[model samples]
Target: MRQKSVLVVGAGLSGAVIARILAIRGVHVCVVEGRNHVAGNCHTVRDQHTGVMVHAYGPHIFHTDDAEVWRFVNRYANFKQFKNQVKAQVGGGVYALPINLHTINQFFGKTFDPNAARAFIQAQTTPVIAPARNFEEQALQTIGRDLYQAFFKGYTEKQWGRAARDLPASLLKRLPLRFDYNDDYFSHRYQGIPEAGYTDMVARMLDHALIEVQLGVRFDRVDARGFDHVFYSGAVDGYFGHSYGRLAYRTLDFETRSYEGDFQGCAVMNYPSADVAYTRITEHKYFAPWESHERTICYTEFSRDCGIGDIPFYPIRLVHEKQMLAKYRDLAAREAGVSFVGRLGTYRYLDMDVTIKEAMQIARTYAKKAGVAALPAALEAAA
Candidate 1:
């Protein structure tokens, strides 16, 4: 019998890491990427017009407390110390996000201490609905209508293209309110951007003698009989012929502009007043603040329902979508010689750290299998 050659569809980080690991162990691997670039949504490139390191898709910040994943990524590329600070413009004033101490003082026209701030916000929130029902109800219960309307309500509506009242309460967790002056977006210990860009990081991972990369190639499984195992990192619903119908997804459209100098004083600014058509404006130069460019590039992000030919960015796991996803998952479970991973495959929003960690776990399972007879166990363990 011929040796089993593994074929991985999608050259994203998840697929790249898996291929890199197997290739290093003397296993033959083939990577098929439909896109010309390797990194999927995390793809970054230098803008020829603005000469800035632009996040081609959108703003992607590497943030996580997982030391193992952080260390693993650093081995291939260097990461700069970048802290995310997000500001929102509401009611003709800009305030720090995540409802920090400074935001409360600015929002209500008063400066209060830590204890006073907590008490003030608590008093502001109404407990009309005993148990919160929808996102609006949860917000009103947590921080009251004033702050909720000013901060979350409009932003959520803009991003999801639905009213807060229609959304589920489970979407809003314990409203993270900081009594201190901390306004950092993420609470992760490790937060930074790859100095050489994410595409470079993926390139470094896939650069191997035993690996054959085929860009602009689609795997149909109709006339393919070479590979021993196949990995699908795309939409699970599409993989199964949309048998359970297409899972709902939210896609993003970026409106770009060239600016002479600093556009927004910061990296990200949210116009959450319901008046602005777009939700947020991201300055690409801010992502790479270390190197200054003569011109700056900014993207006005507009989120909408995923249509045909549109790249699905965020999965909207609503009640109906959840039921459809369950059916798709069952179909995937019964499939052979294939394992699914990543956001689209699993139908979950995953950061870079989680994506890499999942790939690492998949690699371990494959290594333990050792032979063809044990590959099914490896697939089960990976799933």
Candidate 2:
């Protein structure tokens, strides 16, 4: 009997993980990537002039609370311990992000303990607005008008290309403000960057005997009839040629600058003023603080609507987009011998860890259905 063959689209974390899992189970896997490189948005390359590792698309810090997901990534590359400490530049002053105790004191010129600070902020919050309607209302009701204007309003406007009031309240739910001085951006237990680089780590993940990766190959050009199963990680709308209309997405434009020494004295610095055109500036060297370099590279990110032939980054799941996404999901469910997985495949913003975990689960499901050997209990649980 002929062995089963699988075609994995978009050789990013999702596609790479799925391809590796199936390849290890004696399945012939052919991974196709539209880009010339292996890793999609997480692609990292060393700068020729500065010798610093640059995040080709944008910064991607691997952070997860799941121990199984952390262990799975460690098997591929040595992950150095790294914490994301974000700073905000608001009203011509630098402040510690997440509206922590230090920020509260700095912004208000008062030293208040956790309880006192909590009480003070509560008093400042909008009393009338209960069950906030939109992003602006949520910010005002939760963090007060001053902090909202200083930290969220303008930044969100620039990031989404719309007024804060126009966006949904659910967008601000993930943002947390603390009464204590913990300046860590993510509250995840495991946080780090791959020591070598994400691309190197992804390449290691795809290093299997039964796996063959073809770069610069579009999935539409591939003849799907040749493969037993197809796992597509590309945009769902693109698969059917946008028959139900394109989903809304926000793409980023990075203005990278080379500096002699230290530029911003931090990894990430967010500009939260309406006057500022760009959103944030990220210094690449700070991402890998363990490694030292004389020169530094930084990227100033500007967000805009994703257009034709542009790489989609953040999905704007507004009412219209959600309706289009629902249609796409319906179309995807009816797709035979094909499964949609990952950020673009599902039309949702997903972190790297969640993307990996879901891909592993999908792969394990395929393996089990194909009557492959039962994976370890821990591995199955991890997926």
Candidate 3:
């Protein structure tokens, strides 16, 4: 045995991957997941009522350009190739998202050449100061009043629970727009969903006999000294007692409905208009189209600022929050005996592949770190 023990918190994709890698390398590992399930926000289970899979929190479509990340996930679960093509409903018309040539032509009801289309957009964009201020300015600069109002203004306000003008311009740094008729939301080389769902993949990852997983258990309740080392994956703020201050996050509310047949023609439809309370609607059956079922299920996602009782999904990283995060990082740098791993610990919006790659990297790096441990003979005792 190289490393005797490690205490891991939050059994999301990151913690699970780290724990599995550590266990494979002859380290005794114990994973503590605050939730009863393992996959965290990516958790999905088959609905008992309809037998259709439900995204417990929200829809998390996997997309990536990294070949290593793609191959790593494929080892545990088979992925069906699924490209995301999103539709936005604005001004009583459905248009392709990311402002591709198809969207521009359809919106204007004109067939313009690529060069003409590009020039037209440049003319339409608003002129502002050299540097943009907020999200509204960013949108306005990219596409002036007409298009910005139609597409970004309302929906963005609802999602963040703040005015677009108040939000940071960096939020929309990469405004997706095109002069060609490509409507794909993501330009990644690989994109898909797990064939059976995320749970099946996680279950396989934690299948090692040496790895012990206890659900609905908090890491703080467990004795830290018993484990040779600890891998904390929960929110760094929560782990550190929120001594500095609580970080702000945005959570989502999902309302699901079942339909006899196809509810929406596409997998996802964005309601950019403020009149609609929900931001977007997602059809789950379309997520796994290899096998068809009689009925379909859909969920309308609504984003709002996280409250005391709400489950935090996306971190609201604005200017003030970034300043606060710097302090937290300083504290984490000195958080002895505990190695923080995962999105919450790192505090970034990481996808499945990024999370997995990071965890694997941490595992390998820490395995070498075990050599410098004060208690060199602990592994033999643990065995």
Query: Top lDDT: which candidate number?
Result: 2
lDDT of 1 by residue, 225-343 (tens): 67777777888988888877899899999999988988997889998878888999999889887888888889999999999779999898888999999899888899887888898
Clashing pairs in 1: none
RMSD of each: 3.8, 1.8, 4.2
In candidate 1 the C-alpha lDDT for residue 372 amounts to 34
Cα distance off (Å), candidate 2, residue 253: 0.8
Candidate 2 lDDT by residue in tens digits, 146-235: 899899999999999998998999989998899899998889999999999999999988998999999999988356888989999999
Query: Global lDDT of each model?
Result: 0.85, 0.91, 0.81
lDDT, ranked from best to worst:
2, 1, 3
Best by TM-score: 2
Model 2: worst 10 consecutive residues (lDDT sum): 374-383
Candidates 1 and 3, the one with greater TM-score: 1
